[model samples]
Target: MVIVGIEPTEQNEVQNHYNLFKLVRAPNLAPNQVAFRIPPNVNKLDIRDYLTHIYQIKVVDVRTMNYAAKRPVRKRDGAMRGKYVSKYKKAIVTLCDNFKYPPIPDKQSLDEYEDRAEITRMNFRRLRGWKPRPQRINMRKKERYEKFNDY
Candidate 1:
């Protein structure tokens, strides 16, 4: 019996692969350069490969900057405490071709996006049994004194 070999296609090569490369808006970036926020563990080679394979874009050069995690500080004593913020990396990829940034959404679209995001946040808080903070009312000094003087 004879067996035939099949070459892996681009789709087959990256089957079920998921990598987070968040596009960052950098107004100061050159037209040929694009910024992305990647995981700290991702290397320059990985970034190049990811962009080339996934986006079908040719990368000329990739520069990476790693940001250390920020430790939480106590509000009163100003001492470090609580959980530390997650570390992240930023990659500035120079492309073979000039890159044009996508157009910003209109006000209505932004409002809708914010509404959806707020709903998701509220759902998450509900799942975590989070309580909403009391709303504060702005008042004059005399009004505030009168309101609190009874207590």
Candidate 2:
């Protein structure tokens, strides 16, 4: 004889998959983005599919990191005990070209957004090999302190 636990339908299974939602990381990646942390077993391909099919983001690139465990102090009853924290993985996905986040006027405002965008464009030009604008030399210097006199 065999026993099987109650099996939920496909839709029910998918609803259960909502567990992954809770695992996603905070979405505070810069002004125009967000991020998520998934299981280490998830590869770049899987991540791309999830972003495309689930979140619907046009991913420009994906960066990953493998964490390693570290030893901890040993402690016990009137003694010390040793332990280690488990390792995990992380990823950072950059959005593709032409993707733009909707206006966050409440946070950035219009003027602030334009200033930031201009600075960003300048930075990008620099990265693309643009030379820095020439700087003007300051022609002022403080005078040296005079000798102190005591009465």
Candidate 3:
């Protein structure tokens, strides 16, 4: 997609990828309700205002949350660590009851997706062979190593 005259630049871009909205599924959310990951500084009211003014959607309610960053934990011993994560904000915006979300693509798009998946499956089968691999013999039961040989 491109605009007639306007060209996007790295610094000139208003916000980073983090500021974009991604559709998500939530068990608790009702129909036509959508979820978006927003900036930590943005509030619920700001979200409502932005949706109404920019997208022209009538926002019924906006719920925002700021999730805490995960603390680092030891992977195996004190020498290694894992699960480094950053804190982020999420907004659940409920559109007006009258609004309807777009319908899922018909048979054509779904057929395309199925074709792509089939191609990927065929590629894997070609490289690995179509037959199922033989089960691995249990090495732990009959231990072969007399000592802890790192090699």
Question: Residue 112 CA error for candidate 1 (Å)?
Answer: 6.1
Once model 3 is optimally superposed onto the true structure by TM-score, how far is the C-alpha of residue 73 displaced, in angstroms? Answer: 0.6
Which RMSD does model 1 reach against the true structure?
A: 14.4
> TM-score order of candidates, best first?
1, 3, 2
Q: Residue 47 error for model 2, in Å?
A: 0.7
Worst ten-residue run, lDDT, model 3?
133-142
> Candidates' TM-scores?
0.59, 0.40, 0.49
| Candidate 2 accuracy as TM-score | 0.40
lDDT of each: 0.70, 0.50, 0.59
Per-candidate clashes come to 0, 5, 0
User: Judged by TM-score, which candidate is best?
Assistant: 1
Error of 1 at 9 (Å): 13
For model 2, the superposed segments whose C-alpha errors exceed 4 Å read: 1-33, 75-84, 97-151
| lDDT at 37, model 1 | 80
lDDT of 1 by residue, 62-109 (tens): 999999998887777766688887899998999989987766668765
lDDT of 2 at 73: 64
Residue 115 lDDT in candidate 2:
49
The regions of model 1 sitting more than 4 angstroms off are: 1-18, 77-84, 110-151
Each candidate: RMSD:
14.4, 21.6, 16.1
